[model samples]
Target: MSNNTNQAASDLQRNELPAKKPKKSKTLQQSDKKLPFLLLTPTFILLAAVTIFPILYALYVSVMNFDTFGNSSGFAGLKNYMDIFASSTFWNAIFITLLYTALAVSIEIFLGFNLALMVSKDGKAMTYLRWLLIIPMMLSPLVVAVVYLLMMNTDMGILNYMLQSIGLPKINFLGEPTTAFLSLIFVDVWQWMPMCFLIILAGLQALPRDPFEAAEIDGASKFQVVRFVTLPMLKPIIVVALVIRTMDALRTFDQVFVLTQGGPGRATETISFLMYRASMKNSDFGFASAGLFIVLIITIIISTMLIRFMNRSQSA
Candidate 1:
């Protein structure tokens, strides 16, 4: 009887034991590891097709010579680049591009920072105002340029009409070199200031309350606190905004195209406009390609410098 009872308990224990799971095969494990990469293959291919391929082709074309009819005539062996560098028009475009970028970005940063500071406090009116401010940025640059073009018209435009009503002289906004350049800057600042404001406001809101509390406890003045504490904390965010605006400003085309078309004696001709003229109007694809590479190099250098500065600020 004891042996039979022991046998019955052993049987019960054997029956209650869980079944072992099957081990995955080596091939199956390898496939599982590579699954993510396989899924991402399509995205990589698309990026290469759209971005990398064009860049490579442009580099190739930059070395070759193209006829006025857009036919590739043999390799020019850097003649295109030499000619572009030798051209005074190219230098002028570079100067205009730099001036526009610097002025527009600086004014945008200053106005955006002040506007952000003013509206940073919590209130319904501030909320509505913030939305209204963002509306300008949301509009397309081309659309904004077109609207301003009409408004700045000297004869019957609203701006000129208003100025006349106020007994002020009618100003030729886009017809004159100085006013045209400044007008472009004004339009750029009007449209993009809100971008900086939004970015800075987000940064301000994301900042830790501890520092401000500590400043308050130490009886620090508002100006001192902002200069010492807020500015230091906001450096990275400001640099990010600066880099974005700088790159966009450097590539400015629509406003110049619509408002001035590189007119008024090339006063507003940006590098982009110059390239457009070279390729489209002159049909010199090789020259345009070379110019594009030069612009690319300049952009990379500026971006690298800004990034290094940001890193240094963060480290310090």
Candidate 2:
């Protein structure tokens, strides 16, 4: 009886000693979302410092009238903008850029969409073709330019020789204005269309099969199925593709620079190429900075609109 009493006393003492406190939950309640925002503050600060500051600084510099020799500098207050508006050279460059953008994008979309559809079809042949199609995108843009330039050379070009062999006239590919433009367009299309094709193909492959099977049971024709089902589902992916490709195309420099150098009276000179000439070749930093700022604004506006549109479509 004494031993039992001593054991009970010990148990009571141990229980009374203390219980370890419980740890606080690491995760906050869903309502307490502000913690995440607090954690992200540094990222926001860094982005503003790097991106926002430069953009604002460029805009400030554009309004100033400066020259290459660093003389005749003063606050012009939109005079540079006004000059850009008045210059026929600027207008012509804008026109050609728009034309190139439109043609390249349209062709890329159509051909890429079709190629993606074909490749995603269930077959061994398509699988092999898809692998092969990715080769162009794997090559460097500079290497592509060099190879195309060689192929487009008027005197020693394989393309010209092939045409001549077929009893056709040897056309000056990179020399004349029209042919120069066409050559550049072809090279760009060849290089980038594969990328679009791959993107769309990935989107197509990721789609759930139920909608398609259900549509088939509902007696939907091929065109009707693609129109009502596939296109709607692929919208988000297509928007992503558009954003990436447009940004790249707008800043097109390597191919045009290597192939033509804006020759034949600036026939193939894009805005990017023009800015390079101004900043690097002519050493006109202030003017080039202004032009680059304009390009940046246009890019931002376009990207914002596209992202908003895509968000709305996705939500709907």
lDDT of 1 by residue, 1-316 (tens): 9999999986776667664222336567889899989999999999999988998999999999898899998989999899989999998999999999999999999999888878787677568878898899999999999999999999978999999999999999999999999999999999999999999999998999999999999999999888998898998889889988998999999999999999899999999999999999999999899888888889889999988987887677
**Candidate 1: what lDDT?**
0.91
TM-score of each: 0.88, 0.81
Q: What is the clash count for each candidate, in the order shown?
A: 0, 0
The lDDT values for all models are: 0.91, 0.82
| Residue-level lDDT for 235 in candidate 2 | 86
RMSD of 2: 7.2
